[model samples]
Target: MMLTTNEDSQLALECERRIINAWPALSTLVLGDWVLRFANGYSGRANSATPLAYGAELDDAMLDMLEELYRADGLPPTIRLTPLVAEATRAAVLARGYRVKDASFGMIAPLAGLPVSEEAELQIEARPELEWIAGVAARQSGVKTHAGNLAAIVEKVRLPAAFASWLVEGEPVAFGMAVAERGMAEIGLICVDPAHRGKGLGRRIVAGLMGWAGAMDCHSAYLQVEQSNAIAISLYRSLGYRQLYAYETRILD
Candidate 1:
């Protein structure tokens, strides 16, 4: 079992809020402390319901309402279960036959001691441009069809944000972004060209983002990665990021 301190839980909640803000959904409905998000099936993080605040109990009535709302929106009723969720809430979903779908870990690292990268080929942009967006779509298969939605999501980020790209021969080969909220920064949408996988371009992009966040006066950085992605987990661990919490999506099929 994973152990977490009160400070860890609070930080996780803070990161979660930043993530939701940084990646805005097309439509959202707030029921008690739960936030039901819909993004026309673009991405799971933008489409699933998230329990942003703790201590709110989920009863069958609330579950039924959530199901009706999603059904009306042409989306499957999906809930993201995080560490802040109550054990009884998990049981409630299980009783309703919701099965586990995807699991991921929320990771954090302090920006104080991270080494700034010396890569001279990195380019930082105030906003994501066409070239950077196209590079990300070319690398991430899932984002190809949803590129427009992805743009809309990123455009809605109200906080300080930075888009980083690693260039090779004046062409972008890696892409990532950082959004700062309060004293923390959330990194997301990291992708690298297939030909540049083992060449440390991913690390450079991440380091560039962290360096940018540190310059923005952010004390900590956070990111979410699938639990099964060993390569990414290993890379983040090497950069001093530790697992702050784990979350899984439960889908009623």
Candidate 2:
């Protein structure tokens, strides 16, 4: 049996930290209060700012600092908030015209209940194959991951990770990644080809990642899935994943 030494929130936060740490940020300014991250206009998850150690003051000046940093990177200023954020900080961002984007649920589960499909065909790689990278990038709409950025992002993950691709007719149709750190495993980047949906491929890919994590002696697994993704939420719920918290990225347009 796997022991969960940390509380749900703590485990979720740790998983989130490790996942963000895997991103290949072009520039990052980590002050004592918050972290401002940028990746040359890559995905917002890499470029947007995030608040940390919640007790710090979040005033207009800090907002100015964020704007300056993002403007320098040639991107709009955005702040990503989580349940860990202070209520006043969230209100401050909302009071401004910051619209929420990609509000998602942070879900976690023990590896024991994770289900793997025998019919699903998934190929696992330490480094993302060229086809796998291209397949994933194609599925992304806004803030897409170009080939170079995709390569950099995958290569930046120093922890034990597996890039899994769902193959159909010897071509990748879906792609995702699993990274294990500090006894916790994080599964993310789960994307499916629009041409091929409702095939249970997502479940299989997640199962493959969870199995891999379990084999690595990881006690627990976690992932951030969009709240609006009903199919994904249902699938994860069926596989015994529970919501730990929800986070949203607010963009200054």
Candidate 3:
């Protein structure tokens, strides 16, 4: 039994790693002065401080690289960072005069131990209702017209090998997306409609997504959340996500 548990844990960690590598576009690579440049898009190979190698020494090298990239592409000026993990790196950022504007938490849950309540009347759909899913997410996040665009993007990216789920009543109410790449499932853009905030719909959506991942033989799942969002942190904790790490940076405009 103990051996099985250890294997499961290892598998979960591996799955998480794969998910991060799979979705390079949504992934954060480093920090700059004005933009949180993502590894997604036309950005070539990612070269940022690894979780283990990041420290105060990284400040100069990272800043230099960020500046080079910033000038070369004429990208917007902003600091780049992630809410995933970079506690040590983030501390260095704060020491360098970067104030925390927003915060999110990293949360995870083992698929085997998920606590989904059947009483919630939650239903998991295979393909998300792109139109409805995007609208709900945009309204909840205050990103106007983002839903339509996001739906198109998701349709193009989500493959059978990857995992995606929508929490619905008669129509989609919440959505969660994940991809299995390196050996883990990376979860992103989890959203619940404002009208259904307290109804445990978000948890259901996550649970359903995890289930899909598990079905695909994924071992673990991971996500990034802002540090200031305490309510979300609480929800993830309730679902058994412990703090593995923290990441932060400033965005200069």
Candidate 4:
């Protein structure tokens, strides 16, 4: 079914909120309708600023204050240009010499008709265990250095969450996670072993998480993927997830 313009806008807004809630920051400061987040420099989504409302604008004074706050926290001045941000606000950040990076798509699919694989080997825990974190760190290099920070972030999640993994010969080969709130499931942390490529393990892993999401009464599920990742994009598209919005960060180092 096609979404009306207003329905699309509201869905994007809900996705933005669920994304922020699922992967929380250690601390957050609100300036107007923007949220300035910090998580000890773990990930851009956790440490940069985000707008909470559509068409939100930022003045020079507000930008300066946000920059100062980030610097005080030992982080670079960073702002995420999500769909909620105004074009003028984005232009202001670019004018201030904030370099763009990590362009990505926020995709979502309704859970009512989404298929979930009935793979018996997939394992899921309501709370992530140490092995799941270690498995993710082993597969994704970006998280290796931030393992402790990742643990800290996940521990702070108060919503209904699922940590999933697939083991081969008693060793983890794939991992994924899902957090459900307000009838929306924010699915992420999907990783599969390089040796297991082309086996559809990634899809199975996502299905495992979605299976859990459906059980939680989530109406829809969402995930973010870098635009450059064509393979991952194809995988998600094949599973009925469509781009709701795209976002990128502007950083001042």
Candidate 5:
């Protein structure tokens, strides 16, 4: 569904809140009314600080506190940004090296026209099993062995969250989640078993989540996907999802 500028802003704000709500951080700081999140080592979304909701320039104290906090956690302070973030703030980040990460698009699809597949029927659980968590962890770099962290994340997921998985003969082969809030659903963290990549398992997983969202009275489904993921982007487009907004993450070493 096409959104007006006001509607787009509202949707983005809603999704932002839903994501933060569904996956809460271990701690948070309010620097000049900006959000600074810490979630140990789970993922960038939980650990990286962002210049959101705060309009003024960042002060030295804020940066120093961030450095101290993340350093204590054994991580270099990192910042994540969306298109609305100030370019000046980005230019100011000190880093030994930098790289583009999660160069992503916020995409959404109307629930009215989503297609369903028999394969989607394979997803029968609203909550993922431990095997499902491990399947997703094994597919992600640096996260496979951190079962404790992954389990914590799964535990933190709020209600109305849909955890979907594909199992073959009692073993999980794919995993994904749909977080719904305020009439919108965000389908995220969809990963398939390396051995099952050539099949339509990814599509089936996403279709199942979207179908679930529609059934729950959600008006639209959305997600954040790295722009470089051409295959996944193609799948979502084929499913009638369109880009709502784009965000980029600049990693500092």
Candidate 6:
């Protein structure tokens, strides 16, 4: 059953909270523009020896922590806020004269009722064709494909448990990926080759990923998508996925 708007939003928030808490060491660091850059399993000492040493509340800690990030990076700092937490955090940022930008949606599914359309001609693949996937990403985003980008995603799939991909006629078409962690696999990097879109290929690929997650004994799958991508949002909704939360960022002027 499709979730109500309120239910979907709540689910999104819960998913964001879980993801952030699952990897506190990585999630706690604020990157270039207050972006929660690398939060799964990264660890390094902050620039300040006692940046987070105080037992202050989250907001206070974050505010104080921002200075350290700026001092370390030597740049005008920005902050990343997840929509689920934005309401609580926005006032604080505004108080600091920071404005928000770049809002995105966090969509998710429980892997129980993803509709697998029979008519879509989908061919499941065990591994992604790196060159093709990169090419598609580059074309869609106008960015050149780099070896490092491909390598990082490949390494992610090589983790102990991960999701697979789908192709059409031996050509890389769409992909869905997940990283298993703490009883759930956090889905990421789901993309459809623009050339093959509008043919229900995205749904097939997602369905295949859901099936893979279920076979691995995972309880649910989650992913983030930009809120502006209406087509994608609709497709996900048709496949039983729903928004769990929203994240927003404001580029510092």
Name the candidate that leads on TM-score.
1
Locate the minimum summed-lDDT window of 10 residues in model 3.
43-52
Candidate 4 has which clashing residue pairs, if any? none
What lDDT tens digits, residue by residue, belong to model 4 across residues 176-220? Answer: 999999899988989888999789899898877877888788888
The C-alpha TM-scores of every prediction are: 0.95, 0.88, 0.63, 0.94, 0.86, 0.66
The candidate, 4 or 5, that scores higher on lDDT is: 4
Candidate 6's clash total is: 12
Clashing pairs in 1: none
lDDT against the true structure, per candidate, is: 0.85, 0.77, 0.50, 0.86, 0.73, 0.52
**Cα lDDT tens digits for candidate 2, 1-253:** 1124447656755765766665647667875567788776777778887655534346887877788878877898888787556678778888988898678887888886444444557888888778778888888876675777866667777778889998899888888888888788888889889888888888888888898888888888888788898988999888779888778888988
Q: Model 4 segments beyond 4 Å from truth?
A: 1-4, 114-117
Model 1 is weakest, by summed lDDT over 10 consecutive residues, at: 137-146
Judged by whole-model lDDT over C-alpha atoms, candidate 6 comes out at: 0.52
lDDT-wise, the better of 1 and 6 is 1
* Deviation from native of the Cα of residue 4 in model 6, angstroms: 10
Q: Which candidate is the best by lDDT?
A: 4
lDDT of 6 at 67: 52
TM-score of 4: 0.94
Instruction: Name model 6 segments beyond 4 Å from true.
Output: 1-14, 17-64, 67-76, 83-88, 113-136, 139-147, 153-163
Q: In candidate 5, which residue pairs get closer than 3 Å at backbone N, Cα or C atoms, i.e. clash?
A: none
Residue-level lDDT of model 6, residues 167-208, one tens digit each, is 567666666555555445566556777777777766776777
Residue 249 in model 5: lDDT: 64
Please give, for residues 153-177, the per-residue lDDT of candidate 5 as tens digits. Answer: 7677666888888877777788788
